[model samples]
Target: MRNSRNSKSNKSKSTVMFILVLLIVGALAYTGAFGINNIFGYRVKSFEQAINKGLDLQGGISVLEELQAENIDNETIERTKELLSMRINPEGVKEISITREGSNRIRIEIPGEFDAKKVLETIGKTGKLEFKGPDGKVILTGKDIKNAKAYLDEMSKPTISLDLNQEGTGKFAEGTQKFLGKEIGIYMDGDLLTNPTVQSVITNGKATITGSSSLEEANRKANIIKSGALPVTLEAVEFKTVGATLGANALPLSMKAGAMGIGLVLLFMLIYYRGPGIMASIALVFYVVIVLLAFSVTGVTLTLSGIAGFLLTVGMAVDANVLIFERIKEEMKIGKTIKNATETGFNRALSSILDSNITTIIAGIVLYSLGSGSVKGFALTLMIGIVLSIFTALTVTKFLLKLGTEMGLLSDASHFGVKRG
Candidate 1:
């Protein structure tokens, strides 16, 4: 009687935990970090909106710009590429590609950017930021700027605060002392941004630029200033806007292929391993949900190559389940009961699964750190998939198999693909 009561209590707890897991997965699948408005007037955030598509999925603008300075070196080009990437993408834009073309040129491709002219103006501008005294003598340049940020002032107005390096601070102090009570002009590419009166000689390295029309404008200025000025001026030698029709069509085909592949995997798992395969299939659903949610939350831009990587990991996920199930069958054939066989199988398979996945993950990390563009997309997706695959195989599959045995559904050796000895 006591054993019966304990068994019932454990089954009830398992049921509750399984239901909780289902609810969490469902919630993650439908809603992400933000809310989305549907046609029926309901607002809910979805993984579809959270996952950003790359250039191959939604085409946009591409620009080829060349440095205007003579004797431009590879070092200067590399630095410019890094700066442009920081300025254009920052933390908001996704899947923006900036690469070097030749000895003196850069190729920039930004997907889903609507304003080509605005992008051109922002990226191609010389961005020679300067602070000048009333007599038009340059006091400091952007190179001297240590940092720049946008913030709200005491009156709730938008403002840009500048932090200058030691050299800039000294130069600014000297200039302010020489021109007290006069205006200091702030310029970018010869265009005056603001001219503030030097009320007092400032010794501190901090200064603020107020009078921005709005917070957006202030932020824009701050971002440009913080990204630093290019060593050589850039001229747009070629510019074009790419259409998305091809990418749009390609996406459906790619998704169809992926769906078909995953469907086949599920069917094979269900048929080959029987009851355990069914459990593995269920765990796979959780794996997919978790991986997609991870991609959405991490802001990983999904490209064609990334999708391929994801599909590859899906196959590996099935392979892991197969290894464990075969090991279970072997243990069961050796006269172990279903519960003991399950535990021993997982233990025997653990080392191989971890070794394979960990090595793949290391390769993915290396690729992500060293490669750029689509290579990075592929590496990121591969890493995410491998991690989720391992979790599902070890945790979810193991729990479900145990649950099956506890419920008396998988007591017989034949239920786990083993013949009675």
Candidate 2:
């Protein structure tokens, strides 16, 4: 009778501890997602707002352009993209992406861009290449060149290798002789690519340009010189104009559906597995926080597809808990103590969880390697989710279960989904 009274006292204390855990975790999760106003003199912004959003989640313009040439090949398409990249990314990197969709189509996506007319004008500009001498006279044009390549020097520094045709060779030889020791500028569409002083006269039609800071810079300059004019014209076949309001509408709907599903899962866990269910729910809260923190730290661009991957992982996490809970019930029915059953259950469930998650992670890798655009985004989120799911299932869930056992909250068989005789 004295032992029974002590058992009841311990269970009551555990109940109070569980309630406190719930309140604290819930408050923290809410603050992390939505944030609050200023407490003293400092203002706080939400982590969610700081995270980058995709064109579907934010606002953007997508253009599908087709090469209007009879004999266009993959090499030509790549060169075309290089040309467009030069025009769009002249200053530096922006929220822009240029990718190949099929054999003849190239897709360009620019996020937070709504001015369709201005964007179209920029895309339409296909400028000529010119090599102007010291006196601003045209020394050589792009039509005279055979090919340009970027390579490394003997000292492992970056340089550009120029190859000229017969006509360009003669003209370049004469020009170099006249302009020796003078600076001549290589210009593409009125923008200066490089200005190097003439070192000597070259009759062999090959020259090298040094002073490139890096291989990447040399490659950019070489690509411009090699493909100053595209092999075919890019006709904008499809223009998709997405507004910020549309994305705003999409986010709320997606959130509503996701919330409803998560709420139902939490409710089911609470109803079925009494105490272990509560512990798993708390671990899940931390799982969510960790996943979002990972995304924020990595600067992952979130999209609707990425959100789908995230939600799918949430379900997988719940499935793991369900498996462990079932195993605990089986162990308890065989006359084991609650703590012993918990340890055995987690061990038994671990192999199955690892097998399932590892297979999914491999699939995510395949998708990420071969896929493009939104598909790649989804794959990244899926891989991240699978890894995090395994971590929380093994570590966080087990820790919480162990905590409950020590607190004497899981002494009853029914608390782990087992029915006592």
- The candidate maximizing lDDT is 2
Those runs of model 1 whose alpha carbons end farther than 4 Å from true positions after fitting are 23-27, 30-42, 64-78, 86-95, 99-106, 114-121, 132-138, 143-146, 149-167, 178-183, 190-199, 204-219, 233-240
Clash statistics: count for each candidate: 1, 0
Candidate 2: tens digits of C-alpha lDDT, residues 1-421 = 9998897787777667767777877876886788777858765556567567889978899999988877677787887887787666653346577888877888998888889998898788766788889889997888888888888999999999999999999989999999999888999879898998899998999999989999889977887787666667889999998889878988889878988998888888889888988888888887887787788778888889999998999999999998888898899999998888888999999999999889999999998887888988899998898899899988888877876876766768877767777
Model 1: how far is 156 from its true place, Å?
Answer: 11
Residue 265 in candidate 1 has what lDDT? 91
lDDT tens per residue, model 1, 41-119: 8766565566888887888888889889988878788878877886677554467878766578888889888688789
Off by over 4 Å in 2: 1-31, 35-45, 70-76, 90-93, 127-129, 138-181, 193-231, 362-373
What's the lDDT for all of these models? 0.83, 0.84
Alpha-carbon RMSD to native, per candidate:
3.9, 6.2
Model 1 steric clash pairs: 36-44
Candidate no. 1 TM-score:
0.83
